[model samples]
Target: MKNPTNGSLAQTFQTLEEYNPALNAGVEKVALVLQTMALFFLIVLFIIELQNYAKKLNSDDGGLTMEIVTSIGMRYLVAFLMVMASGEILDFIMWLAIQASKWVSSVLPEGTYNMTVPGIKGKVGFFEKPIVFLFSAIAQLAVWTNSYIATIIIFLRAIQLFIFKALAPIFVVFVMSEELKSIGIGFLKQFSAYALQGVVLVLLMGIYPALMQNDFLAGDVATGMDAWLTNIGVFFLIFLKALVVLVLIIGSQNLAKRLIGGG
Candidate 1:
């Protein structure tokens, strides 16, 4: 029985040894085919990009050959520089926002204070307590909304970093072709606008810290029902401001596209 077991083990090892080369060969073949396909695709893209260059050169340019060539060259040069310095340039832009945010953070704790309704101090009516609580809940909701917006902005910035900086070389190729250069320039402008939102958000955060000493929803409970009512009104106005900020952030890319002459 031991001899049979040993023979079986040997057979298994031998079979595995025999299969290794075939498995490796199959993997290598697949890799080679995939690499070839990728090469073919890149070549196609290169051809298309070159064709765009040719089309632009042949376009009616009021016989300004040297000027057009020089302009295109300058643009490509700038694009090359951006590609090489993509990480550094973007990091610097982000650093500015970080610094601004830090300044805002230093001011935030000092600005916040406990919610108080001076109107409800002496005689608390039946609905007065509930109204105060309601206003408090609304204040908490506003804070939560701001947090949510900040999180979304951060997530979008991460995506932009990955797409613009990581794949900058690919985008740079687009910049060399007149037909595609607009797309490239437009993309860059849009990304810049997106990044600039961080500054705007920081400024908004700074405003409250500098101007507001306490929650806008906080009011004198002793002032009776009018206190919470005033807080709700203030909350709505602040919420409107938040909505405006969101709209600006979302439409920033379009604004950039126009500024860059994208359309």
Candidate 2:
């Protein structure tokens, strides 16, 4: 499969915003089934609420009244409508989050990271400087590996968002009950974390180019063996920086959660 993240930073964000695993026919069918089941459960819960209210009506306290009954009915009606439109609601949330991140990224200097292995100008004399050659090879491999892993992480995050979308209807039902509201709130927090993760990733992308521009490297001029050694060292440093970027990207969801006070 083509790497979805193999694109400009803006394109990557667009891909994430547009991702919908339920576009697959099988997944669509499963989501529909889940939605239908949720609707059924919602109806059952509403009936149970009415029964409990009726019991309260029969009590001497007379705490429950017709207005409260109407309020309960209206609450379920709204929940039912929200469950029916859950997909649209999720899409809107994702779009809003991605757009917010994009706006934030726009304020930063514009640049892109080339995740591909940096090309070496001359062939390495493997017999003479074996350790340099080995380090050079390792750095190139690390760059390629980082690119591959970043693509996989983006793809997996899309899948996670899809799973959250599929379960949204069920969670909407949870929100209808005071006893289960926390469960529903937890689901929303996690969904928000994944949704807002792009913010951190975009910010990192915006900052990476500036981070890589070293004054010492910018002014340096080397010749002969020194030049070759310098290139190896520079590539190794890039690999190290790329490794740190990958770590930050992987932890982005947690960072998002913390930002939203989900922790």
Candidate 3:
């Protein structure tokens, strides 16, 4: 009997497939490289935007404030685009890994079976109608018929750092004109940033590889892009998470020093 406490992860661990030598390494390498490039570019772009923003805000140029606002909005837009692109790339990689595992399993000396991928997407349910109103109140009233694009644009404009910088910290003062307090400001900032992160990733996780049919990583099996998807399974993703953690730890220390004034 399986323990409920062990959770789906236990199943995942138990089910890790052993694939053909050529397919496994090939898919993994391709996934790893593509994922690494995407993450690397995201970090690099974030840093670039941050520096540019710091300059625009602290500069005396008359147009600096406007430039900063535009830049921030566009950063979100670009970030959203990149995130969407990455998802397609990931799907391609995963699909390849699964197919390779299937092909390899069919020909295994011992004869293997039981291959499955764990992914679940719940569609709109009857009970979810009430939530539509909640989202709609916050969501944009789009003029364009392409609701997705409008939502993305509206969200970018409304939730970006520059807009939040102006909006999140208002405080009522009896002594003088009102001032904005920084209380709860950190939460708001993080929430908006994370919201953007989720949407970006969701978009990328679906459509990326369609853009590059030849992008799969199965080198041994690929004569053309038919082998573009990878075979690494989830190990490459595990490695990427470690990289993000390392980066966050180092970046947090630097960020803390900057905020509170000390290294």
Candidate 4:
């Protein structure tokens, strides 16, 4: 049997990008039905807007002018086009975000130190310094747990992107009315934030290596007890650093949201 954990982080992300549960046949059919219903409602909204314009024309306000009609018609037309191409637009946004993240990672300085549990284990002798070995093992576990959590968050974000893609048509209908345009704009902002989460993750990953490059416990220890104490302190510091990185990775979505002015 194939081991699920054998996949690298990059492979996991690639899989997530390719996965599209929102495009399931049943979901697509449901979205189409909802889109049809929303289009009908859009038509009703446009008619109501025209009626308002007519009333204004009868009044001294002169809001029933050609410019107003043209604006309303344009809004409805744009909304219609958006609803039709919602999936493609969302896909493009996601692709753009992934590409941006890859570019950022490519530009960042690569770290020389091995931050993995196995890497740490290889550095210390298991039998000679059992206490230090224990610390390294614990650090390894912590690193693995942190990585797993980050992967889960990224996977969920991918799912959210697809869900947004599937529902874009309905939310975009709000753009047809001036009063409800903010709702549509808010949806787009939220989607953009989620899409940008990958970029935040890439940045954190790129920076983490540099932060962990220096070995605080590099020198030889004078005594066994002293070595144990020193290794323990170093391990504690390592844990603190790893914890900070993990927290940032988990909160990447919120960070992205703030970056894009999304609530």
Candidate 5:
């Protein structure tokens, strides 16, 4: 009755606070390493291509027309600019997705409720206290699940940001070469879908809370057991949807390739 979850719940939340930041920092370090490698590979590939192009230009059928030369220069210039502004561009795109998500959530019903015992200082019976405590714990579990989902959304967006930033040059080169253009288009499709994942997750998170709120209100008036069971069911559904979002994001690259006629 007197804060049944005092030690364990405090420890759990404390652990979350300590580890989430560590996990985020570690992921960023790994992302930076990968981004460096991607940049290196792009440079190597560009140099090799440039040499080959020079040899071709010196041949009898060589020498690019002003139009072709200008087009190629412009394409590389675009690629250069994109790579330089990749971070800002990515941030802007992510901001837009978050804004869209906020707009959608604004239209949905609010999903807020309280699940706690009130005035329990020698007022309620000892037996009733434990029961209320149990319900309160369950409600807290629901709250934790929501926070976990939000953490996942942040992690996913971090990953997408890394991918886009690391491959900004590659994406730009897609416009320069006909052979690699489809691959680039596929990459763009993949990027767009990945960005939308945040929106999808935001919307999904909103929906479950509303349903839980309805069930919670009804269950309070109806029966504690009913509300508990229904809330659990709804949270399970939310977990499953979260898994599906992860799968879709992971498999999006191949799907994008297929969609853009790339083998």
Candidate 6:
């Protein structure tokens, strides 16, 4: 099969050619448009909210509405940018991963197996093919995307934390004024922090550790114990990570309540 972007730049500038210029440009364009649109709405929303805040702030004993909104908005903006960057980074990882797998297969394998990736078919020797494939897959999906995803998750959790912090004051009043029976929002804010924190921690903490033990890490013999260990290790790693995350959710919410005074 022929290379999807460019064929066999392998002999010259091997790594360079693997990057698809056309796709990169396209991805960049889309990201730019999204950022621009998001910023536009953010600014417009900020202006409107600010105006509303101005009117209410002085009327309500001139409280800290302006400060709270400004701070939360800044956090929201940062979280949004991080999310977009995470997306672009994921695209790069996906493309490079396809190429890396092929390269490894070619290097180690003395012509053991064939890999037809991105619609391009090629023969990979047994010498290093398995490791190559494992490495490529692990690095591309499990590492590159994993890290950014973790960051995204963290920032997302932060965003939720910020929102809850912003709302805690309002909810207290709502509980008092609207009857305890109608305090659904209060309960939601209390519980939401726990749920969000666990998710972020699991994605970030467990991913790389699992990747480190990958079959790609060393040796051939993808048979017997090696293969079983790799598969089982991955499962347990993720499970443990998830457990850590759960601890964080419940724990962090309590911490946040004490430190940041949020639900």
Per-model TM-score, in order, reads 0.52, 0.78, 0.19, 0.82, 0.51, 0.30
- Tens digits of lDDT, candidate 2, 80-142: 887888767777778878777767765765444533444454544555366666666887676
Least well predicted 10-residue stretch by lDDT in candidate 2: 1-10
The residue-by-residue lDDT of candidate 4 on 149-169, one tens digit each, is: 877887787677767766888
Deviating ranges (above 4 Å) for candidate 2: 1-5, 8-11, 15-28, 50-60, 115-130, 215-218, 222-233
Which pairs clash (backbone N, Cα, C closer than 3 Å) in model 2?
Answer: none
Q: Please give the CA lDDT of all the candidate structures.
A: 0.47, 0.68, 0.33, 0.69, 0.48, 0.40
Best by lDDT: 4
Off by over 4 Å in 4: 1-17, 21-30, 61-63, 111-114, 117-128, 216-225
Query: Which window of 10 residues has the lowest lDDT sum in candidate 6?
Result: 112-121
Cα lDDT for residue 21, model 6? 51
Overlapping backbone residue pairs in candidate 5 total: 0
Relative to the true structure, candidate 6 reaches a TM of: 0.30
Q: Which lDDT value does model 6 have at 200?
A: 26
Q: Candidate 1 lDDT (Cα, whole model)?
A: 0.47
Question: Clashing pairs in model 4?
Answer: none
Report the C-alpha displacement of residue 202, candidate 2, in angstroms: 2.7
Higher-scoring candidate on TM-score, 3 or 6: 6
Better of 1 and 6 by lDDT: 1
The positional error of residue 81 in candidate 6, measured at the CA in angstroms, is 36
Candidate 5 stretches with Cα past 4 Å from truth are 1-63, 112-150, 217-263
- By the TM-score metric, which is better: model 3 or model 4? 4
Model 3, residue 26: distance off in Å is: 2.7
Q: What is the lDDT of residue 253 in candidate 4?
A: 92
Q: Ranking by TM-score, best first?
A: 4, 2, 1, 5, 6, 3
Candidate 5 minimal-lDDT segment of 10 residues: 1-10
